[model samples]
Target chain A: MALKGWKELEPGVVILEPGNTIEYKSGTWRTFRPVIDMEKCIHCMICWIYCPDSCIMVKDSKLVGFDYEHCKGCGICAHECPKEAITMIEEAKAKAEEAK
Target chain B: MVEAMVKKPIVKALEGDKAVTEAIRQINPDVMAAYPVTPQTEIVMEFAELVAEGLVDTEYIRVESEHAAMSSCIGAASAGARAMTATCGPGLALMWETLWVTSGLRCPIVMAVVNRSLSAPLNILTDQTDMMGSRDSGWVQIYAENHQEVYDNFIQAVRIAEHPDVMLPIMCGHAGFVLGHTLGRVEVLPDEVVRKFVGEYKPLYSILDIEHPKTIGAYDHWDYFFEHRRQLFEAINNVLRVIPEIAQEYGKISGRYYGLVESYRLDDAEVAILIIGSGAGACREAVDAMRQKGVKAGMLKVRCFRPFPADEIVKALKGKKAVAAMDRCECFGGEGGPLFIEACSAFFNRGLPMKMIDYFYGLGGRDTVPSEFCDIFRELFQIAETDKIKPPLVRYLAVRE
Candidate 1:
């Protein structure tokens, strides 16, 4: 998105539009990404409860995957997981592996 | 601008604080939140009595402190209510942080600041230090020379602050004891006339409107902080044009006129004195006395200080041999006082080669007599005649040696 000039901004920068925070991608600040192993996963939904950014995806009351777009990858879900189904990986290593 | 006067003013002798309270009674704002402080105490006290009498349907909130007073005003104003508050000296200091917040949120809250000195020995009297300290807090500042001007300034302040081009807070400042405690004849307009004059306050955006909800006081970081502040700068500058137009409209109803700066005998004069607030009265007297002695003396009273009125001030002082900027507050460790610094910049910007000096007086409620001002004019004349500026450009006036 293009930045606004001073003339284009509103007086006092009052946000006229609600829910504008979604425009900012917090995922850009991530240093580590969380990966889940489905073979070792239990449907206890501990990761869903522990994910601070609500990045844990759920479907039909079942654990699915992670929402990477908004996740900051704090590793809270991996730390709180009871079944040891999730692991934290460095984002640089993950991107390098993907590039291969 | 000519409209037939349909209503006659009510002539009454009232104290300055009472005169302002009467104006507030006529304005009848939607909400008032204030905590008491001397000189300014009478305004809130009398207005509270009016609220008890049910003369105005305003929600008067007796807050715990000046900080809360300004905070409550911000909330009320954000919710689309006409809000007002008053304070002085330490009270103004306590609300210093919130003052920026009020202006940052663009709340058109009108406040009557009875100018008083800040405490060291804890004195209660008249000075400009209080408001001068907050001069850069992004509020439109208007100084009054007497009781009537304070009354009139408050009425005009409502329109100026709420103007769509200029959605900013305004401070109508008068000297603490000089105008706030003194009795003077103030001609007040009819209540209906004032009501009609100020009209209805239509907020551009209200937080209370659920149908079109808007967020105020949101956080802005490096990406947009500069832009938001730039808008504030533009809005305050817009007041430079809006003030004269509103003052002209106000003059049509009341027989008195106002401007950004009032010039007394500046035309065709070689020497002049620039001042603000109630001190202008003594300066005017000194100017008149100097004229009797065949001296080319004049006075420039700056009613609007925030915008600084640089162009208008330069124009007024143009072709003059010498001028002095009299300030009631000390700048301390700086080159000179705030007004002096600003006047110097104005002259320097225009490349005007006029002899200028800085005078500090009336700090901590000290009396600045007409003779003191006459002494300043005498020194200015010598500067004009010699064309040789003296050392120690900034001098203390009316202080024990």
Candidate 2:
């Protein structure tokens, strides 16, 4: 009545749970670079609300945001921001060029 | 996982995705089911075209959706035929339910999920979100950094997934735009050589036959669900046990080494950063740069993500002061990312490192340079050696308080 092992599952059907041998790079090297426009910026928490990695820093309903640590640069916040206040940029090479 | 399978070295140049197609072609799967999306769509299209040309004699199932692509392949594979499908993002998400069923059934079908972005705006771009989201499915997942590895992994994936102890559907991946669309020169071995690499499907059961009648997708009750699941667990735990045998066999056929974890600068590392997917290349370049500058940073690129390789991870980072779990997917209130959460939970039974910080980057095909990786390692080393500093919820470039 009950299937016990590989035999009972199906006639000669191999019983396996699942195992992944391949590994992905930890978040694809996120350096959150948020772009905000002060002119069109209307204070809204939509970006904050939908931050997948929650890298936004908000105070007094005004955007004084930083990439902090977990910023994956997913650009979700930038994409969702009602004010067009954020544009995601990569910090790896861009920042280097800026320092140069 | 590279091997010299072809005896005749009449090599032809091909792309990574093309190489995957060729590898699957050589494997000679019975049913090839696929849907179109970026990165991976090219590979599937190439294969579909291969079918049309009669270059490979196989039933090509052009499914309407990715979910169906995986499902139809599962049916074909369940009936004791080697089967495959390719998808990414929404396609991968569509196949989520079937992914569970295939693994639970222990069907050794092969699928490739070119990592791509999920959507609200319905962007048809690249990201690891889909595969990371389906991380729970009982499927073996592998991430390929470039074309060479993608070719090698595709060939190796079938063998590993089909192994008696590791009977699960497989999804080998690469960065969609980076590896998928990149048209670099790849060697296309003769069909004979590839044939040698992938011999035949040694299915546990025969395809729909009059003699061997049994049920698939059957009902299992509360009396023994966990027990059924435990058998799958044993298969995962024991995969490493038989992997070496397969790797050794592969080495005999092909010279490339498919290793436990590709370690770079890990010997004297105070901080070990673990990278998965194609981004490992960036991490490797970053490690080299760090080494040149006298920084004691090392890297462990995870070649396999499923089977949860806990022992391998713990052993790799055991004595290291800290480990950074870089993930492409965000984990909301949980750890910084999915890889971080999975790796953190993994250390429960081992002497895992104390400090772990997840760095997110390159969603939707953004380029991640070596310098950013170096800065991440620099920040990671400082965090590991001293009092731990909490990671900010959102870290953006130029958004410093």
Candidate 3:
């Protein structure tokens, strides 16, 4: 019984359903973003499997790109890249570079 | 569900823990997760026997830790089960976090607490320390004065906890060893009567319900935290109204009456001693002794501790010349004890003019006999007669210190 406000929800209302974290937009908490160099990429999909937020996108056994929408930018993907294909850049700098 | 019904009660000589086990057997809850702890082990032990005998269909999970015990109950309770557990002392301390989780979620789980002293010097004796420590965890707390009351409290707890207006979990406590090990005459009601009385488990919200899935224990942030907490207060506030109604129903079945507070010989008394749990037994004798000595002394036993019967207390001790609030647990470095602080504050808030003092007694299973209570009542009588409370208003009774 959810009482008035979040009292019934209790303090720090735990997310109930699975995959609801996608709606949380954790990327907003990010100060840095992982940028991948496709030419240097080995397509080993290690980053795809190791991203804590599951932000690394893969289609048909191939690494496509980072889904920055939900990435908190902890740099696990950059840290996990065996081929040195990924680089961590300031989110604002990446945005400016993209804008350029 | 209605087929397995027995129509008459069987009176039996049983200890406090056995009485709790009998009540659990009658109620036949959906889930019970417990870990063994001293003074509380017999309760889980007997219940486990029932489970082994296949006498009840309860899912008895013998968990590894008290934390897991309460955690499993929380999981089952969230899944719309009538979940329960039992423990005492450090076990209760271990389950502290999950106690908040269960009560904060408004799960109607019932716990049978065999009250024992907390450990520092490693004592395993009867006292109110353990349960008193968890007073703020948002659960309804009831103290039984005897073995029969222990059984009655546990039976009634299911109703109180499940009452829609008051879905807070309940902890029904009795003194460890003192009551937990002592045998007493307990008249248990017919299985059908108890089953019908406790009724079926109704789920307001269930994690297991697929069609109407809902979130429980959701991560509540500061934005709405106050309102959520206020909801708990709203439910507990409803308990004052709900408890009596449930007790009245219980009375209809058992031919007994109960209330939040039991006022004994207080009507015409000039001085009274207020206490909780089994200590009232001695306080009553002290009251009798005071009466023989022409001192108008009485006793008020607070059966329900949480959603504390503040109004009942204020009304019971209002016109008295003096009162002594006795606490079984100590609140070190604080003003008096927990019960004393509450009683003092309650009287002060209600504008009741009475010379009041508090005493710490029966700590770590140390005995507080009728003589100690007589001493307390005598002091209260002195204060009432002279309108002067002794300088050290808060003192330890019978302590070497």
By TM-score, the best candidate is 1
Candidate 2: tens digits of C-alpha lDDT, residues B1-401: 23334443435566767878878888878899888887677888888888899999889987888788888887888777888888888888887888878887788888877888888767666668888888777777878877877887888888888887787777888888777777765545556766766677877765466464555555454655666676677766666665556667766665656765677779898887787878888888998889888988899988788767677777787777877777776455664777776677778656444567767777766777788888888777777767584666334322236
Q: Is the docking of candidate 3 incorrect, acceptable, medium or high quality?
A: acceptable
Candidate 1's C-alpha runs over 4 A off are: A30-100, B1-8
Worst 10 residues of 2 chain B by lDDT: B391-400
By the TM-score metric, which is better: model 1 or model 3?
A: 1
Model 3's TM-score against the true structure: 0.91
What's the CA error at residue B257 for candidate 2, in Å? Answer: 0.4
**Each candidate structure's count of clashing pairs:** 0, 46, 10
Writing each residue's lDDT as its tens digit, candidate 3 over B1-401 gives 22222234568999999999999999999999999999999999999999999999999998999999999998998888999999999999999988888877888889999999887989899889899999999999999998889999999999999998888899999999999999999988888889999999886677887775566786655656677777888888889999899999888878778999999999998888999999899889888988898878899999999988899999988888888999899688988998989988887888777688989889998888898898888788788778898689898888774
- Per-residue lDDT over B90-163 for candidate 1, one digit per residue giving the tens place of the 0 to 100 score: 99999999999999999999999999988887888878889999999999999999989989999999999999
CA lDDT of each candidate?
A: 0.90, 0.73, 0.87
- Clashes in predicted model 3: 10
Q: In model 2, how large is the Cα lDDT of residue B69?
A: 84
DockQ for every prediction shown: 0.70, 0.04, 0.34
Q: List the residue pairs that clash in candidate 1.
A: none
Candidates, ranked, TM-score: 1, 3, 2
